[model samples]
Target chain A: MTAESERRTEIMDAVERLLARGGVNAVTMRAVAAEADVSLRLVQYYGSTKDQLLGATLDRLADKSVERWQARTRRQRECASPRDIVESFFDEALPTDRESRGFHRVGVSLEGLAITDPDVAGRAYQKHLKELADHLTGLLQSDDRSAPAARLLAWEVMGLAHGLGTLLMTGQLSEPEARTLITNYLERLGPQLCL
Target chain B: MTAESERRTEIMDAVERLLARGGVNAVTMRAVAAEADVSLRLVQYYGSTKDQLLGATLDRLADKSVERWQARTRRQRECASPRDIVESFFDEALPTDRESRGFHRVGVSLEGLAITDPDVAGRAYQKHLKELADHLTGLLQSDDRSAPAARLLAWEVMGLAHGLGTLLMTGQLSEPEARTLITNYLERLGPQLCL
Candidate 1:
């Protein structure tokens, strides 16, 4: 990678770390500079402002999350069915592990920010959801007789996964209970999967 | 209402306003006092701390939200099927109107807080979810042949409502789009509704 791009990634990583530890409130230009071990001027040179920095970070996180899912699918070797894609989506989305838990925290923080500060975080969040929806819908549509409502199904699945992730994170639903809930959901959704 | 209870409601209302406007970070004891037109000492007399104030506010909001749904169902004056209950839930839960939109904002703020400060907001959020799930589950059970997984279904509906509410608020999904998504969802969930 170019030296400039490397520095950018370093700065973004610092932003993510701060965001994961605290919510959106913790991420300021100065704090990110301190976290990244760079000067505030260097951080400013990259982002110009805190919102820009956050927006770029969220955009990068969005792509990385989608790539993570795709990489997993590739490693599995077989052509994954719609059910497999969704099952794996839940498995990946749930905050059962530390990394995913941190990711979910960032997501919730972004979600709240998107509401309160709808210009920067809002656009980034919309892009994130759109990318996920497009990717998932494309996968579901690959089936010859895919449901015409593939996009809606994608949104529904994404919505459920997000909500369930919060429930799991907040201790409202245990890991086992979450598993059963998804199993039951997939069972009911069996017919629509058209597999 | 007694003077004390009325004063307490006033203080909590101030907290909610601050939360709705600026999120959890924006809510502090001093800010609540200023917003409520009361003294800081009076706010302290009511809450003792910011977390306590936020927690009490969340608890009251949770009850009021559940009550809003019950009142709506009662006004309809008919036995609501599982599908109907779920349908009305989406109708009410979606932040299409200003009042509901503000409610959704406060909810998202509390959600972010629950993750960052679990001891206070987390307990309140869990209670909110538990109360909603229990109420919805009981209503579904009244159907006499409710699915064995009524509680699971309740959580699923709540989760979907929340996730979709975010989507709607974020401008990702239009109101009509949300309606259609829920319609498709309820249609697929038809057999299981067992009504």
Candidate 2:
């Protein structure tokens, strides 16, 4: 990549770190410069306003997360059952590991910002949710399950994943306990999956 | 109620309004005084620091929400099934109406504060979650469902309620869509309810 694009990428990375560490409130322009190890002028040159920078960062995050999910799906065999897909989804989505935890932190931060700062961050988060829902719904739909059912199931799973993830993050539930909960949930969903 | 207690209650009500309308950042000392229609000194006298005031507000909110749920449960028949309880939970938890929407707004703000400001607000939010979880678990447990299972189910329900509520609040899912989703979930959980 060119020097300019690399610098831009570095700036976005800084924004993500600040967001994960201190939420939207901590992501000031000066803080971004400090986090990125770039001068304030360069940060300004890359993105004129904090809102613009945050919007762009969110857009990039949305793309990257979706792409990562799709790439993971593509590597799996075509015969991967709906059950396998869901089990894998739970495994992938849980915020157990350090990397996943950071992602979850970013997610909750965005969720908080989305609710409180509707004008600046809300549009980006909605787009992120829509893109994710559409992607998951497409993957979940099968000949046995109706499209609407798949959509509803997708939303339910997304909601559960998000909520349970939060619980796990906040130390409300342990990893083993969360796994058991998911297991019980999957057992209930077994009939629906025709498994 | 005594005049002193009444004044305290009014100050807390103002804090809740500010939190709901503009989140934690909007609940400054001067803002609370203005919102409460009282002098700054009165606000300080009620709660010396913002953190102290917020902690008191969260404690009150936790008690009020749990009390409301318990009251609802009391009005139901003794023979109200676990399924009924879960269904009622969804009914009460959904932010479709104005009051519920404000409650949800306050909840997300607190959740955000808890996650980011663990020093000041985190303990209070966790206390809120634990209290709610314990109460729900008590209601959900039965002879057939083990205590562990009941606890897991409670967490799952709480998680779904919170995540779906966020989706609804953000306008990603309409009220009808959220209702349909819960209906589908309840149908799946019907067998587990053993009714």
* Fnat of all models, as shown: 0.67, 0.62
Docking class of 1: medium
On DockQ, the leading prediction is 2
Q: lDDT of candidate 1 vs native?
A: 0.85
Candidate 1 lDDT by residue in tens digits, A66-104: 999999877764957788888888888888987788888
Q: What is the interface RMSD of each candidate, in Å?
A: 1.1, 1.2
Candidate 2, lDDT over the whole model: 0.84
Each model's TM-score for chain A is: 0.93, 0.93
Q: Write the per-residue lDDT of candidate 1 for residues B1-195, one digit (tens) a residue.
A: 999999999999888888877778789888999999999999999988888888899998888999999998887657666677888888889999977888888888878878866768768888898888888888777455554478788888988898898888888788988999999999989987865
Docking class of 2: medium
- lDDT (CA) for every model shown? 0.85, 0.84
Chain A of model 1 scored by TM-score: 0.93
| TM-score of every model versus the real structure | 0.91, 0.96
**Residue-by-residue lDDT tens digits, candidate 2, B38-154:** 999999999899988988997888788888777887788496788888888888888888767777877777776676668455678889899889988988888887788899999
